[model samples]
Target: MSTADSLAKVIATLDWDGDLGPASLAVDEAEQLRSRLGDGATRWVAGAVEQSLTALHGQIHDSLAPWPIIRTFTRHVLTATLLRLADQDRLPVDTGAIDRDLAEDIVARGIPLSDITQALRSMQREWLSLLIDAALGVRPDGIGVVPALATSVTGTMDAWIGAATDAIVEERRRVYLAEQVRIRSAIELLVTAEPVDVEAVTQLLRIPLIGWHLSCAIGVPPGGTVERRVLDGLVHLFARVVGSERMLRYETSAGTVHLWVTTDRPARTPRVEDLRVPAPLLVGIGEPHPGPDGFRRTFLEASDALRLAGSLGDNGGVSYGDAALAIVLSRDEERARWFVEHELRDLATDSPEMADLRNTLRTFFDTRMRIAPAAERLFLHRNTLINRLDRIQAVLGHGVAERPAETQAALVLAELFTRRPEDPSTGRHEFGA
Candidate 1:
């Protein structure tokens, strides 16, 4: 046969299937070469895996693929490639299952596909070189067959790479879906008042259950979306503020995030003014509380505070301490309104005159009913303040001092429920300011 015909024959007879049975003279010859290599083939695979690992390390600083996983995958690829060459027929390597498993793990770890492909390419080079050297060592006259063997090696490696690409995409979709389900289940369990296995939940969510937790409810404007980078930035900020290394977060479909920063010891509540929240984002923070029960309590508090902030059109952070009364009173809106109207009477109206009277009353209560300080704070003459107080008393048909606690509580509830339009330029409610 001519040289071209001889090359064609070699290529045609080369087995792509991994069958070990004798199919032709070429198969017998290839099998003899593999048998002669013996432990040398094993050594080649090991060497190739090491080389590939080294290459990967140089390129990727943080790959989620563990040492054992990488080694196992590399060995399978090399072993299957070698088997195909020995069989000298079409060797269909079964790397689909392994690829899918590995791809899912890598995707979950957030490792880029480029890193995986780079490692695979490194292994391909090492395996090809080793196989060629082995072939020449066993048969010095096999130089002419080198092209056909190299073609087979490249073809098999390329197929593996294609399969891996598809696996990576599929695995990414699977991981995203699985993660959503896991987070939803965890949130439900943690928020409910039902008895729970704290240990099991901690393991499932991978967060500390018995530490000091400072919960925060972070919200963007309605219909907004929170990107991954934004969430990461928020986590870093919260961790730094609370001096905690551990944190747990869950993002809702409406672009709200519930985050908990945990520490071993008590942590100070982050100051609202110090938060420096940006525009279009509002944050509600719960006080630091300890243990599993505290976790649920703090989360509830933060969520309540967040709703209050949103309703009040607050543009910045609001702590539970700041919104505690509003949150509590707003819980029973009907009862709260009745209490406020009953206590304040005519002063409970949203009229400007009533608002002024309520402010004066609030100032009076704040100053311990000291007329001098209350008058000064309200910027009113002493007699003017006294007259307003008399008017307030007449509206209630009693003395303000007669029901100080109830009057004060009623004033707070009235202020909380008063409907006020948000400032156009500042995006803040008058009460918030």
Candidate 2:
């Protein structure tokens, strides 16, 4: 039997079928073994018995899939096996101390069981050396072609051919796998935006919150510089943890926060949309959809939200959708946008019935607060009003209702943002559908 075969039998001594911890230990042993093998050979061997390693890894790593880990380990094992053969002088001479040092470090850090075992078939550089010594060139029973191979020039040539075959097979296997990684990566990029597109933008954009495995909530704070520092640190860490193109942008206000991240593709360009936002520490609900108008261009919308986050932590920020904000953005760039940002966001626009939310909101301003009355006047039930409010609440999030004043102010801002002149020529922007 080959060394891999012997090891497989030895593995049965560990009872890998039992508990997870023991299985992990078995995996660790496998890793230690591969630490001595070569990376490529390891990969090929793992491929040969992929099913076995899969089962072992599932029993070992438990949470992290055993497949990727085993595959990775297999590569390492092949590398180690190659280095060992070089050491044995059966192959061209090369350094092995570097590998020995690396193995030592891995051992010091306590290598995971997941790092052990798989397709690394224990194919050492001395494959010919061992075969020549044990089975092929010499056999205790008959010495059939053994003695001839050990002595004749043709025998040496044949041995070399076998060695050449092993090396060629490994090289071809590597080429095939490299092509696979490239093709697989391209398909993955089409599905996942981070690595394929606009990944660079997230580097500049900031994220104020993140959690382990997509959980973005920050735990409630007790309030102090310590808490502030901790929370701020968490925010920065969250941004850093996300670290790249997988991130989103956000805007906030006295009553809400909106996200403005775009999608990753060039042709399928993602418009800036609301990102998650809330006071760094305050606990309350915020709207889910884009909030009321604060005239903002795409880039400006994103930038302002990030900037606004620094100044208006307690205030809800960035309430309007890109459509609503885009209107003012086209005309008086700074003034209208600034007014909405600073002065007028919380005035009052008449709230219409839930059904009328799609219509021009400016018409409702005459009532001081038309949302409830309009719903009633429209013969809509109180539940209907609540639902309309709920829809608005879900869209903009519920954070803005900190008090009546904030709610009223947001209402007025909505009206002002929507106000348009009767004559199409009054404002420089040529009004058209």
Candidate 3:
């Protein structure tokens, strides 16, 4: 065969799917090429190729370190490609196997096709440059054959990459849809208030079966977008702060995020002020409790806490610990209102006189209704505190000194009922007192 015909036939050898016998290339043609190149030339080229591949692997590693599966798979495919080329006389290149496995790895790792494409292009460029230089060193006149070699190498690469890219895209879509279904199913099981198979759930979610769990319910303002990476970083941050690994999260159709984090030991759970999260996100963290029952309860607690968070002050995350009583009372609006009116009378109204009385009462109760501590807390003298207490008794028709427990409860209900949803800081003196 003419030189052109021979090179064309060699290129055709790489096009086989699974019919590679012992070698991908024809024996006679391989022998002829080896003879033309000389054995020493083949050894030198293979060694250079190996060193070049190592360097390229390092570069790929740096670029795709975040995706370990893709990084590892790319390295494997490069090594396998080198092996096929080096031993073309005895082994065939099964590009199909490489393509299939690479595609699967990409999908499983959640890597984008664009990233894989970029890596392939980088490898193709490096391989072509190294191979062409090796070819020129072996045969000065071999420059003419470089184009054919390039076409053969790139054609095989393009075929495999194209197929793998398509396969991974389709697989990723399938997995994404399947994952959404799984998330929905898991949520239904959690919120139905029925008995759930906790073991089955733990196995399915790959989370701890029982541990101290804190649930956080996060809601973004309308028109705000929560990217996946941001959410991932936030979850990692929470894990670090809480010191736990058994964490699970779900995003609702309403664009709210629910997270359940489990820890082996329960400490004083951190408040939202302690966590690093977006300012626009409204967060409510539940008290940490143990086991699957704790998991369900904490979720409910966080969800409920989020509702009353706006009235607590600041858009920062609210903890159930601080807002639980207010949240509970606020659930029944009419009852809370009625209780506030009957118990405290006009003290429930928003007015300067009512504010002075509420502040004094709050400080009085917080200080255990002590005459001295209440005076100190209110920054008032003993005589002034006495006067305020008398005025408070006149308004409520009961002396403050008589009903300490009932007085405290009434003060709390008054604060809860009078809380302005738009301005959480309205009753700060009353709350803090």
Candidate 4:
């Protein structure tokens, strides 16, 4: 055969479906050479590639680091290249479908595009080495065959790389654009509080419309910028924990993330501790409710809880519904402050002596003013407890025995407002020692 026809024969072999191993074609000289020499070479090369996958996995360590996928890609590409050489006829090696799928997967995994490029290049090198080995082992006299084989391998790989690179880049771009649209639409639909197409919001955000939903308000301390990578990691982790993609998130300009997570069963709502949120960032979870209106309500409650946590010097998560009374009272800061200051008067100031006195008063009321029980609870002698109560009466200019209910209510207010030290300007920020 002419060199052109020989190359054509090699390429056409790829399109041939019948087995061409030596056992299947011993009688025919041409079939025997192509089988033992061509298909056999490809099989030997594929085995070598399979053995090298573990080492390759170590080199390309990332989200797309599964060895089986790498192994398959390697075997498929090498087999196609070798078959082309055996038939010597042009056969299309269309790996675009697989490339597009891999690209989409890589993008979803948040892996860098460079990793894909590096992985493909690594495959080329490994395949080339095996092809050389196969050539030496099967066709010792065919030095001319080696060059033709090498040319075919390189050409096929380059085509695969170019097509895959384009597909990966385009897929990554599309994913990012879609995320932006979803976030923008979610933010608008939530903030406006107008009745929107719930189905549209659900489809856009990929979250459920009718189910138990808990909103979480996540934010860093003032003056801190939200790290996108950290936030993305948090979102991904949260979704994984819930075992669902039915979650929506929107990040505010002030470095706060408003998130909604839904589950069909109310009992399955994720708890604050389960989230394992890290510092300088606080998370506030809302009560779980059903449907779109529930989502909105829970979001508002979560926002309130976030503010309440900040106010209480709580640098962690707070459940809004659990602390409803305090949260409601905290809304009127001036009134709450005034109520605490006027009601407690000189008794609520920050000092060890005052704290002791306040504790004694609290203990006395908790025991229903029973002197012995109050003293026992304080781990004090009755006379000592009486002396503390006397001190409290002296500070207030009235005895606890006079209108105890009013005093108890006043003490409750004091506990809420003055439990932590007030910063004078920023209200409570630090706890009194």
Candidate 5:
């Protein structure tokens, strides 16, 4: 650590001109590498990494591959900053903290050395592949380039930079793909994965085990890549279980997919509510799971969306996440009361006939406002309706006279009673509707 050596290191760092060559050695290596390596791609991965920085604000990266690299780097740097703040119990970066000196601070402080280092090592290969696949955008799964269908700037995804540790993106891809397949296959089998089907999944998808009754889930892209295969394969099985109902599968982790399933028939998407969930994870297909907000979407929403699509038969897709609170946890007596009280405001109360009406209302709303020849087709009397009405109004109070409020209140209750809280693992009993 001589002063001249330190000065040389500083100058060399400043130059970023060449590796192993003296600070003065200027090589056309970058351009040559770009020409030699990019396959006519716009940017070279090596140059991208060499020049990458973790800024306080957002970056100015190109729209493809290396974007993940920049994003991952940016996130880790930001994370390191936050962690530092957390350690010192002070807020270092915030809306105003993009102080421009954070980089120097990180370099000086060696922030999050172990974490950033490990993440970078792990993410290396993915970053390199990103140079190729970001532009490809999942279309590669379909034979040749497939003519790069009118791609749009839908959103961005990032892989934490692993190149910093001298690892490449390819290696990380192996790790990322293996983990992703494991999760996807697990969820696939957990819900509908059969024992016989397990072997094929293991061989094809490389997932190892299929546990029973676990509320596991996996990230799914909106359309392309693996999502199509996963959802399309499940369609037939879903069709058997609930004819004419919609199905949906949201990645619930990424911003890339706002996957939506729509149709003109019956459907069901389990509204997200706090419930026991398997270990939550994030992957590259979409966005990083923003935690519970990310995991909030349940297989139920995807199911409902698919069912609806089948009904009207209009094809649809699954979607994304910015984090969502699962409403299932709120389906308790308080929330049920709160929903009615808020929506109905004046329509929440208890009366016997109202109790019966409540039952009918729950059925009607849960059935999506269709209580017609079905209810009457069972053969009821006009007085039956009249009595139900009287009790409903009696319990709901003066606001029940207000058609809008009354309708909304009844709807919330109906939906409330329909939460799927039947996790045998938690010993919570099923709600017998």
Candidate 6:
């Protein structure tokens, strides 16, 4: 018989299902390795991944494949490689689904094709080493079949690589189209004032709309750029801070990311300091409210807060509560600007002296117009505090306490709308500095 017929006859005679051939021996050796490792299949696959990664360490840069994904892929490849060795004809290994999944992961993670190919080649080497060693020990003339067995392994790997590459391309296309659809759906659900079918919107967005929602908006300043990985990291951090897992996100082309954390109970506000937000990225969070309307309301609130942060030119988290009054006043920015300029007159000018006076005035209001307390808080002598108050009154030509409500509103608008030079020390723009 020819070599092809001889190889086919040998494969047919082998009891692939029984615990007796080279396949069984290779499996047993792998199991023994697993036993020696003492952490079950995870550790076994991790060993293979380590070897593969080590082989491609300097060859590829910026590998985004997570460890869990690598471990799962390694396990699948190991199983499929051994199975393909024993049953070339009746290859029961249906790795098509897993191959597609792996392809999607690779595309999502930005893992290079070469990295995957190199890893597969490394696995093939390991599998061949184990199987050939077993075959030589079990069969009398196993050396003669080595060439055919090697050929089979190579063919299997080549087919897998081809399939994976095709799947990767398809996944990339799917991801782009899916993103476009999601963006359109999100805009309809969140941006429009018109009512929507809540159930349909929820199903389309894959998020529940019938729970308490705490919304947040995160974005970089204009002319700044952020990566998707950075945004995803921020989302994970925010989820941890809020202690919620049910999160829904909508990312825009402008690099703004809006998300909501939902719960059965009322969501509590997260501590801003605990966020430890990085520089150049601002976060705005809204108060928790219930139901679908609350979801949209909180999203708008968060967006308003984000705008407040941007206007302040500060790279930090801002809660809706922090900017609530300003947001209300700035709704009609033209009128708000007029009110501020009219109320403060020359004090609204971007000047250091005016900023100091505003700070004192804000502190005085915070202390409920108590001179002693305000003076103490400002670390000023009682007479010095009174003198500054007198100066502030001079600028407005009225007593600071005369129109408390209107004065406070104007102060908030001025603080938000006034353009000041950047403070190098704090990396923020002061009210009027």
lDDT (CA) per prediction = 0.70, 0.33, 0.64, 0.64, 0.33, 0.68
Rate residue 357 of model 6 by lDDT.
Answer: 93
Worst 10-residue stretch by lDDT in candidate 5? Answer: 148-157
Ranking by lDDT: 1, 6, 4, 3, 2, 5
Top candidate, metric TM-score: 1
How well is each residue in 1-433 modelled by candidate 2, as lDDT tens digits? 4433333222222221222221222354345434544333333334423444544555456453334443444334332333332232122212221133333333344444234222122222223233233333222332343333233323333333344334434444655567556544432332232233333222223321111112122222223122445545544544443333333322222222222222222112221122232344321111121111111233333333333222223232232232233333334434544544443222223344422552322323334446666555656676765565555545444533434354444444444345432321211111111
TM-scores of all models?
Answer: 0.70, 0.24, 0.63, 0.53, 0.25, 0.59
lDDT of 6: 0.68
Candidate 4 per-residue C-alpha lDDT over 370-398 given as tens digits, one digit per residue, 9 for 90 to 100: 99998888899888887888888888888
**Candidate 3 deviant stretches above 4 angstroms:** 1-150, 221-233, 276-278, 401-406, 417-419, 423-433
Clashing pairs in 1: 15-88, 15-89, 15-90, 16-89, 16-90, 16-91, 17-90, 17-91, 18-91
Report the alpha-carbon TM-score of model 5 versus the true structure: 0.25
* Model 3 lDDT per residue over 210-232, tens place: 87788887765545577777766
Candidate 2 stretches with Cα past 4 Å from truth are: 1-119, 122-316, 321-334, 337-433
Relative to the true structure, candidate 3 has a C-alpha RMSD (angstroms) of 10.8
Candidate number that wins on TM-score, 2 or 3: 3
Residue pairs clashing, model 6: none
lDDT of 6 by residue, 1-433 (tens): 5555444334333222212211112354455433432233323333444555455454556455554555555555554554455442222234353456666778788777787777678767865664465446544556677787788778777776676666677888889899768656754455454577878777766667777889888878766676767778888898778788988777766667888898888877875566777766888888888877788788788887777677677658678876799877876777988999999898888889999999999999999999999999999999999999999999999998798999999998888776522531111211111
Per-residue C-alpha lDDT of model 1 across residues 310-360, encoded as one tens digit per residue: 767666757997778777877766798899988888899989999999999
The clash number for model 2 is 61
Better of 4 and 6 by TM-score: 6
Native-to-model Cα distance after best TM-score fit, residue 284 in candidate 3, in Å: 1.0
Between prediction 3 and prediction 4, the one with superior lDDT is 4
